[model samples]
Target chain A: MQRLDPLYPTCPIRNVIDRMSDKWSLLILSTLNQNGIMRYKELNSAIPDISQKMLSSTLKRLEADKLINRKMYPEIPPRVEYSLTNTGQKLMPAVGMMVDWALEYFDEITK
Target chain B: MQRLDPLYPTCPIRNVIDRMSDKWSLLILSTLNQNGIMRYKELNSAIPDISQKMLSSTLKRLEADKLINRKMYPEIPPRVEYSLTNTGQKLMPAVGMMVDWALEYFDEITK
Candidate 1:
């Protein structure tokens, strides 16, 4: 049997799973996956319903986790763009599986 | 592209994902998977950190979602036990993938 404590907050796996399971993280990752590299305004537009505060924080967390890359231009305007890092890109397949599962059971579960 | 809206509040897939992504649902589901059939008290003991309200509500949601089987037996006192439904069983592989990914990257992400 695996050693990590099942569902315990103290588990290291919980570090990733808990963060990933946050309200906006999966949505943000899914958005970035579909839209590719995008500027802050573009991402904000893409996910219009997210509060600016929430979006900014979620982006920071994803960046901190190294799941997404943030590029800052030294231009006077200081353009910032976001895209999935290699690790984040690789994570898409698993997210895709979850999405597929969601799609399959969406009606039954939600109804 | 999937017709489901990408990360929108109006989307049905969001209905499933958002609910599943709730703070306690994954933990509860994972516990059930690890422990097999368990009574309400057993579940409560297994995840000692979860509040009674949160655990009960999460269980109801999982049961309603058809991801868990809730069995009730009537004797002098009622006995209720919970286990994974077939659909929930199918979901384990995707969850396993995520757990694997988390295990591999936990150090980098958490550090």
Candidate 2:
């Protein structure tokens, strides 16, 4: 029972799984993987049905986790682009597998 | 853009990914896969740091989503056990991949 909390001192794997399983985190990573680097507005436009607030919040969280790099260009219109960091890039394979799984097995599961 | 929201009417895969990526759903399925059938209290005991409320809620969600089968026995103590459904079993490969990915990549990312 005590082993379940990945946050526990002994449970080193917990945090990693938690981050990967995060809802918007994986989606944001997938979007960036497919599109390369994208600006805030671009991402928002790319991911339909995501509220501005959710997008902003999700990006901030991803950036803080160091999974995505946020580059801000100082200009009249704030130019902020998000790309996967090296660490984030390493995760793309796993993320890609998940996306593939979704595409391959969704119909079977639903039907 | 419109293609990103898997939940949209046109997005058939949305619901499947949503269910698999659900926080507790994957974990419960993994636990069941490894241990076969486990009673409610046994599962609660097996997964450390999960609140009873969360465990109960997560189990109910998995059951409702048809990812797990719940069986209740008539006895002195309530005997409710959980196991993966066929749909749930089909998802194990993907879920196993995720767990493997976590174990393989966490050290790289965190370092």
Chain A TM-score by candidate, in order: 0.86, 0.86
DockQ of each: 0.40, 0.29
State the lDDT of candidate 1 residue by residue for B22-106, as single tens digits.
7678878888889999999999998787899989988987887799999999866899999999889888877878878887777
Estimated TM-score per prediction? 0.88, 0.80
- Point out where model 2 deviates above 4 Å: A1-12, A108-111, B1-7, B74-78, B107-111
Model 1: what TM-score for its first chain?
A: 0.86
Model 1 has fnat of 0.47
| Candidate 2 residue-wise lDDT, B1-111, digit = tens | 122334464344455555655566666778899999999888987777788998998888777767789999898887888998886786677667666766765554454
**Candidate number of the best lDDT:** 1
Docking class of 1: acceptable
Instruction: Report the Cα lDDT for residue B77, model 2.
Output: 83
lDDT of 1 by residue, A43-91 (tens): 9888787899999989998998889999999998999999998888878
Q: Against the unseen true structure, what C-alpha lDDT does each candidate score? A: 0.81, 0.71
